[model samples]
Target: MLDNKLTYVVGANIKDEKLRDYLKYTENLSGRFIKSSGLTGKIRVNNNVAKLNHRISSDDVIDIDMKTDEHQNIEPEKMEIDVAYEDIDLIIINKRPGIVVHPTHGYPSGTLANGVLYYFKEKNEKCIVRLVSRLDMDTSGLIIIAKNQYSHMALARDMQSKDVSSKESNDKDLNNKIFEKSYIAVAHGNMENKSGTIDLPIGNPNQDSARREVCDEGQRSITHYEVIKSFKNADLLKVTLETGRTHQIRVHLSHIGHPLYGDSLYGTVESEYIDRQALHAYKLIIPHPRTGEQLTVESNLPEDINNLISKLKSEA
Candidate 1:
């Protein structure tokens, strides 16, 4: 069952702090959320309804019912969804390629968000759909959806706090990060190096243009890639991002002279094995928003990318 309440036992570290301040800092709750919860009388101290200014002491029990009457603007539609993992705080969906993540200008309905809302409604959950991470319409992989305002706020803050300038890309460094996203792709050339880092700034040249390129005056973007296998004409590479920029992996791989196979927007090569970009978001490691425990979720490569890999191997 989904628990919509948060219970915190005051410790020495937070003793004597104001409830509002404790909620904002220690619990990572947004001011708006705190105000709303307070207005709705959802916060209690020691089983009694408490005000925001209530003084907290060690061993005091804090209970917060996080349920809200918030409603989504998008209409829920029944559709098949691949749920990779689900808990009280978050849902990790293994998104297939060629599906929009949410409703946008061009896509008004029939999105993953619509399906998720239907799923939630069927399960009698009355929370807003909050996307912690996003993927392009054609990029298949895992995407995160926060189940409540508190989880959404916490996860969003963690994503923003990521340090993209760090030079380390090893497993230890990745584990230390609040969130780690990994991808697998087939690039159009035999990589000269087995492993390398692409430290480049990315920005769109024109405000209206959707394409992004490396520029001196752009946001700092970093991508770390390791060639997993070499093929006659292409290479299978595992990629990890230090920064999440629009089209980061595509732009980085193309900039390094190894564009992904079948990438129409960024690649110069035409592929017969696949009709879309041979890229997949395969893994994610995140800290649970409420519990602070590490969670690792992964999705297997979709069939198109796998078929592309097999074709490359046969050509070798």
Candidate 2:
């Protein structure tokens, strides 16, 4: 029931500051948003229209309406979607393997985005599907979608500001981050170490190839992993990403000789154990786009992965 509106009460510390300064610095709104809202007459103070230069005092109420008329060209397909979390500002979906997240060149319909659009239509909600993150077609896990432009902007800003490469940080520092993503993966071999970090660079050799590799000229990538359980042939790992390079987990694991089971692109080919890559986005922690409150969402392993683990257990 929450609308596309933002409200703030001026505090003593920010009193007497220009509205533009408060919004740009304290509220973290982008310059584009400020200009657009100002032109659209969506900025108000104390029930009166206000400009970006308006001066405010303590106890002043500022409101910004953030509604949009933008529409997506994607066709809405009626399909079942696993919604893990939803609010007026955003939604988190538990994506299944073998389904693309959005429309692409080769995939135009029957995607998660199409299904989400249909879901919104059914609920009579006027919202666009703005994906904040994506999972590969074979990777099953949580995907975030912002319901409005303002929420998308806020989340995107926070994601860009996150320092995912902080290896020596304490628990408090970790808790202060705006977003955290975790995964569960089954690798081909039993790892020698119980826990470890892989700090490397990943890049594609050419633009025509879909493969990613660790190379000297690549961008910095970091992955931290811990052994959750060991089988005779493979090991279960809880992996946390510091940098979200394309195929970072697969490339880094393969570089360290622990490629994920069934990962044909960067590791071994599909086997009887699993038909797709044995990777799942299991958990996510993010701050509410509007309220700045912490939110954590999780998804259990899919049936194929659970069966794979069972098969591995039997062999042990």
Candidate 3:
């Protein structure tokens, strides 16, 4: 229903630590970005693109691509979603472990989208799959749901360009677009520093590889980390991404001599939770696609992780 372009630099950050708060609290605001950038476009974020409550930072440029288009009806799904928060414009859900964000293989059904579709189907809300962000199949945390297509494009644009990016590849090598993303993880050993950054290039090793290798020819990747807690034999840390590559967190941690506990792909199988890696997405920040507002979401540790931490601390 909004139909005006608005833009600004955030003068103050409300108590709402997440940008979605602003989207929900402000009446005139239409869109925002959690991790915004320098760019311009005509994208009106709707309820479907991103939530309004996400955190927006001060001195950050914002633009609102207010909707001038006809309305489309979307229904809501009553499917059990651990909704961190919700509004007409966006939905933030805590994704369960072991569920892929999108469909593939024999997982066309029983996915998060499947539950979402069924929930919306029951509510008669005109809903569609316009996810603003993606989480790994086993990663559990806040998953952002953009309600519409315009906001999807706007948000997607900013996420795709947060890091050093390029679009040039030789005919012999037509695969090169680099971006950075941060993460939080529990490492198996004691690191010497309070914080550090890891730079590595991740790339394909063979045709259609599910695994990535550490190579100089690979794309550029960076991961920054700070120890949050130290356990008897393990440590908890918050990782900030500087690039977005498949398994970037896992790979970076492994490369930096602190592989994630139980990480079968990279680390030794000497941890308590052998089936799961000790990594959880604790926070996500971005700018709203439609309104250019800043947004952020934080999640508490999953029960499995908390239990492990507790047990580790008890031993200490």
| Higher-TM-score candidate of 1 and 2 | 2
- Which lDDT values do the candidates have, in the order given? 0.87, 0.87, 0.63
Q: Each model's number of backbone clashes?
A: 0, 0, 66
> Tens digits of per-residue lDDT for model 1 on 21-63?
9888776677988898888899999999999999998889999
RMSD of 3: 11.3
* Candidate 2 TM-score, C-alpha based: 0.92
Candidate 1: C-alpha lDDT: 0.87
Better candidate number, 2 or 3, judged by lDDT: 2
Error of 2 at 92 (Å): 0.4
Residue-level lDDT tens digits of model 2 in 68-187: 776899998999899999988999999999999999999988899999999998998888899999999999999999998788887766665564444323335334655888999999
Off by over 4 Å in 3: 1-79, 166-182
Full candidate order by TM-score, most accurate first? 2, 1, 3
Which candidate leads in TM-score? 2
